[model samples]
Target: MNPLIQGLATIILGVGGCIGYFYASNLLLDKVLYPAKGPNIASNIRRANIIRPWLFIFPALLVLTVYLAYPVVGSAYRSLFNRSGDEFIALGNYVALLESPEFRRSFLNNALWAIFVPVMSVTAGLIAAQLSDTLKWGNIAKSLIFMPMAISFVGASLIWKFVYAVDSDIGLINAVLAGLFGAGPIDVIQIPFWNNFFLMFILVWIQTGFAMVILSAALRGIPEETIEAAILDGANPFQIFFRIKMPQIFSTIVVVWTTITVASLKIFDIVYAMTGGNFGTEILPSYMMSFMFRDDGRATSVALVIMIIVLPVMISNIRQAQKELR
Candidate 1:
């Protein structure tokens, strides 16, 4: 009954059971239920072809329903109930959330993040992608620029936290500023409103790499002849990029924008690790966590709000993907 052993055993059993069930079920369907050697061999083969894809897809559909669909519904339901879940409060939680100053601040900060992070990240990424391509050691430059994408949000926050640390000696930014200006250390995170941008800079740094890699690929995929024609027509580098190249890569830019928009809405770790959602840096996810145990209905309401905010971006991304597929 050791917890570690029990967990390992459960994992093994779960994986083994799924493999066994799928293999056995497929075997049963082919061998016992519809033997290909029998008189109706052609019919059996056709039926198997029709059912095989569904067999593979069914497990994924079930997992999506269980993991994704369930939680959304559960959150919605919880938001309608009281803290103890014994009493129904209807739209009271949402009304309270909209009315709460803290929630309003979180909402505004989140909105600012959604706007600032994506735009700045995409802009920085596009510039890096375009510039790196023209370099002789472009691949090396791209690799260096893309490096931060490998770091987790919390890890990046820790790294930037040192840069923003109150101590002038240890923190890189304050130390340099102090040395230059002969001033004391600055507690950047304690500064209201502006501190949110400081946290946003971390995300922009991390996501710029993502945007760069994607946009870089999109940039490279552009036809060389088009750029050659642009140059032949007396187009400068800026003209070639803005007028000729950018139009082609616009879709990818939108993709990167919406993708990062969704991410900024769900940002938690950086703010949590850096400021613990204090000093005007609180966002929706962090606010939800703060209220989770103290007030279940309000916590769920905040979660639902976050979901609502991200849902449209998700839908747009999905639609764009499908359009591209078509």
Candidate 2:
């Protein structure tokens, strides 16, 4: 039961089981089912050649079915039931979610997150990318900007919590305000309507660095000859970037945008850490947590809703990436 021994045992069992399964399955296929040495050897071998790839993939398929696929299907199924899950109440949880004021508020907040975070993060990142590329010490500047991405979302939120603290001496924002204008200490997160944005800033601050890193690479990959030609044609700096480079790397931008959008849609950590979904900052994931244990149906229904919203963006991202490859 020792933690280290348990981990080692898990590793050994996992690896050993995989090896044993593959070996045993192959043996069964070759010796029993296919029997490549038998009277129907040629046909059996051909059949096995066709089936061999699936054999290799079967374990992976099983894992996916057990983990990802089952959970999705099960959540959808369970969402049909009532709070206790003892009675069948088809579409009941979804209806209740639609009726609930908190659910509506959470949905709106999630929408705000999905829209605001990706747009601001990607735009800021693109600008940072361009500026960093233009500046002499751009790499150093990028490193400083990107430092936030290295911090976990919870950590970043806690850091920002101090900045937004109510105490003038303890909080940086209040300290500066007290210095310049002698403004009173403010509990920023307690502010209604706007507090959602205040919470969102933590995520944006964390994700902006990720966007910058991605967009910087994309910018660098733009052909230099195109920029040179644009300059020869009397295009300004802004025109050269928007007209020339933007078109070239739009796919990468979409990839980054969708990636961030999906993260924002399912974001829980920053809200959970800082606000705990209080003060109108309740996103879907955090909203779902409010119903945890007490109302399994509604919690899962919220999860399903998050998935429904995110699935399309994910699919679009995939298709756009595929188009870029083509």
Candidate 3:
């Protein structure tokens, strides 16, 4: 029962079982149910071809139903109930949730975060992409900037927590401010309303790198002819960017925007690690986590709210993907 052995066993069994099932099922269908050697071979082959795709997809569909669909449906169902889930109090949790000042604050903060994070991240990313494209050491510069994307949210939060620490000697920001401007040690994350922005800065910092990497690739993918054509028209750098490059990469920008938007909606780790959802920095995900064990119904309600917010972005992404696929 060693952990590593257990893991290896699980992996072997899972993969081996999947391979065995598919092989056995296909063999049974082709050889046993409708043999290709017998009469009506052409029709049997056509039938098998039609059914084979479903057979291949069946396992994946089942996995999605269990892992993705069930949780969402179950959470929606749970959101209508009371604390212990014995009493069916339809919409009561939502009503109480909406009426509460804390939840409202969290909702407002989330809205602000959703707005700021995506826009700023995308803007910063675009700027980085453009600037890096002109430099000889651009890849090195980009590697440094995009490095934060590899850092975990919790790790980034911890790093920023030290930077924003209240102790002037310990916190770099406080130390710099106090040394230069003689400013007092500022508890940045303790201030209400504005504290939300402070917390959001961490996410923006982390997400900017992700945004940069994606936007950079999109920028690189832009044709050289378009820029040359713009140059021929006496277009300035700003004009070239806004008029030509921006239009070309608009869909990519939307993809980055919606991606960060979804991440912001589901943001939890940074806020949880840094502020613990304190000082009015409670976002939907963190707020939901706060009530997770204490109030199942209410927690599920918050989760549903987060899901509702993300639904549009998810749909938009899906449509964009499908359009691209077509």
Q: Write the per-residue lDDT of candidate 1 for residues 188-221, one digit (tens) a residue.
A: 8988789999999999999998999999999999
Of 2 and 3, the candidate ranking higher by TM-score: 3
- What would the per-residue lDDT of candidate 3 be over residues 1-326, giving only the tens digit for each residue? 99999999999999999999999999999998777877899999989888999989999999999999999999999999999999999999999998999999889989999999998999998898889989999999889988988899999999998999999988998999999999888899888688778788888998888898999999889999999999999999999999999899998888889889888888799989988878778888989999988999999999999889888877877887799899
RMSD of each: 1.9, 2.2, 1.6
Pick by TM-score: 1 or 2, better one: 1
lDDT of 3: 0.91
Q: Pick the candidate with the highest TM-score.
A: 3
TM-score of each: 0.94, 0.92, 0.95
261-321: candidate 2 lDDT, tens digit per residue: 9899877899999988888888899999989899999889999999999889868767867
Model 3 RMSD in Å is 1.6
Alpha-carbon lDDT of model 2: 0.91
- Residue pairs whose backbone atoms clash in candidate 2: none
lDDT score of residue 17 within candidate 2? 94
